[model samples]
Target: MGREKRIEYEGAIYHVISKTVSSENAFMEEKDYRHFIKLTCDAFSKYQAMLLSFALMKNHYHLLIKTEKANLSQIMHEINSKYAHYFNSAHIRKGHLFQDRYRSYLITNDEYFINAFVYINLNPLEAQLVEQLEDYKWCSCRYFEDKDNAPRCLNFKEIHNLSGIEIARITQFIMSKVSESKKYGREIKEHNSEENIKKIREISAEIQNKYGSIVKNRELKYLLVYALCSKKFKLVDISFALKMSYATIRRIKNKVEKRMTSDAMVTEWLSEIGKVNAFDYQNDHKVPGTL
Candidate 1:
């Protein structure tokens, strides 16, 4: 069987979890944690996603994300791929870093959202990694009290609006334990029901379908490079896919970035292609849960 298709849409919230391959420590030192966090912030900004909360464990990490666009896969790809590249280079290692594609649970309502928030913050305590949630240096719990020092990627205001919990009370709420039953099996039934939104289309295919032949269209080729890069496709992989040289791919990407600022038409074209690049999941089922 093939992997399950991820359900994605604008404004969708998810509890995303990714573990290192073979349960190895993903963060070997303080610098590792800092670098991962920096990469995460950059990815969020580049993809226009909002991070509500996060907890980084030794082997695994949890993230509560509310995507403003239907580009969760793209966002995660950038973060994971970039971090894996950095980690492998820093440690003089190679091969896969993560065990598999990250797992995500759709959060459909405020109740489940709050539950996930608390659940993520409590991971350290549940694993006996820390006696106090605030003492966990890697989690977002401590940032609730020190917003000025928190990563710019974290959206505490959105968290308050969605969870209906005030920013000031968030730390207190997380510290208070909820029922154990609420923690497990709380994800909705629709999470298990899979429906094909659309088959994954390559950047070349999308460009060809939208703009016809690109053999002589220099602008379209640049758009292709931009779209592929936005999806976190490596330069070498893109070169193979487009039958272009590595230097040409980088040149096209640079050109696209420059054009985006000065050319409105170019910017519009890229924006339209971005929507095409995002996963579109049509879900009508009501998510059941209560606080």
Candidate 2:
């Protein structure tokens, strides 16, 4: 039978678990664990995902997440695939590290939510790997025990929303659940923002260097807009960065997305462009003597 469909929706929360394919420890050492954590952080940044809690076990791991967009597949794919790459290269092994597709349970109620959250944190203690949750270095339990030590990847806003007098009370609740087997768990526009614009300018400069000159300013604009969007930057940020009007930025983004998705000519042209150094082509403008 085909794989089951995931229940997906904007603002949907899920408890995601995945294990190594062979029962071998995917995280073989401290560095391996830290590397995976780094990749996890990168996924958070790229996807704008909210990571409420997580635990990294020897052969398996768990994550409690709420996505701002309906993009669980994309988020998980990036995290798993990227981590797999790093794991393989570091271990000098070749093959699937994770077991079959990740298993995720949708959290539709507070009961399940609390259960998953506590369950994940208690994984180490349940496994007898550590006597106290605070001693486990990889899982997020330490951060919950001490907020100052929490990494940037943790989403405290949601944690603070818990129905408790203070964070300490919430931690106590999570700890109680853990005793029961564990508990639950941007860039700107170019000008006004130097960072994104710097990226855009770099791409523009490379294209110019490759093609000798940008045939039209619109081509330059399209490239800048496309680069910004690819970074998942906001349209408003793109507009401010490039000093373009919001409508113009939106138009470029929409046109680029439309053409790239539907127009064979545009797709082939982009592929060809990527092969060589990035270069600008006039918008709807033929190359020299083509028209």
Candidate 3:
């Protein structure tokens, strides 16, 4: 069987989709996600590829990128292979991590280019992994949102020139697309679905029992807030569910955000609890009386 040709050339733009084999979560933990992001940045630097936008979902990722040189094949190979190596070594697994060759569509026209950009940015929200685009910290959406400190890997100037749309209008355009995608997604009808909210409470109670002696209430509050936020629950709803005031919920959320940004260990256990809760939910496991 002849290998499929990747139409490569200097200055070619493409929408690339990479998936994991058997729908396994390629990035199940925060550290794994961070490592992949670092490898992606390295690959971009190595190949001189211009990343317009990207979103890293659990089992797959979407990238809107332009090649500065005809090196898409080399770039993808390096990124995927290196990440697979790291994942295999860390997880004690073997064999192929990626499903197959990455799927890519050439962005030939301006309309498709803009569509690809917005679509990539909306992946997390559409998958119900996040309530909003900005909430997904791993995405390049932040680069577009924060113009003053825009990413060097992402050439906003090139995107602006190609689309003839100013940077000032980019956020609004992306927001509109996100709003449209959410309409179809609508995965979580309410911020606090009763079942999931109950799951959150159960997870909290379990954590409190195990770590309550050593952990302070303030730290626990930070954990709860961060975990709920990561699960796509609204602050107001989390406040109501956890019996905290809106102001307190917001404060805790901010504290956790700052800790995470500063790479502190504050509420790291709580985040682990959140991951456990998610795993439980997926496996339909019961926790004590919660059954």
TM-score of each candidate structure, all chains considered together:
0.63, 0.60, 0.59
Residues 1-291, candidate 3, lDDT per residue (tens digit)?
Answer: 986356678998888879999998898788897888778878999899987887888888877789989889898998899999999999999999997788776664565567677777777766777776677777777667776654457778887888787876776788787655455234323321334445556666755664462135665557756777877775654664577787887877777777676664554454455545433543223221100
lDDT scores of the candidates, listed in order: 0.73, 0.68, 0.70
Better candidate number, 2 or 3, judged by lDDT: 3
* TM-score: the better of candidates 1 and 3: 1
Q: Give candidate 2's TM-score.
A: 0.60
Give me the overall lDDT of model 3: 0.70
Error of 3 at 125 (Å): 1.4
Q: 1-291, model 1: which lDDT tens digit per residue? A: 996557788988888889889998788889898999999999999888999999999998999999989999998888888888989999889988887678787664455677788888787877889887678888998788888888789998898888788888887887775564144436432332112112223546755665665676766667757877876655654664466787888988887788768777776666555554332323222221111
Global Cα lDDT for candidate 2? 0.68
Q: Which stretches of candidate 2 lie over 4 Å from their true place?
A: 1-4, 162-165, 178-291
The deviation in Å at residue 159 for candidate 2 is 1.5
Error of 3 at 92 (Å): 2.0
Query: In the order shown, what is each candidate's alpha-carbon RMSD?
Result: 17.2, 15.1, 19.7
How high is the lDDT of residue 199 in model 3? 56
Off by over 4 Å in 1: 1-4, 180-182, 185-291
Candidate 3 segments whose C-alpha is farther than 4 A from its true place: 147-152, 178-291
Which residue pairs in model 1 clash with each other? none
The order by descending lDDT is 1, 3, 2
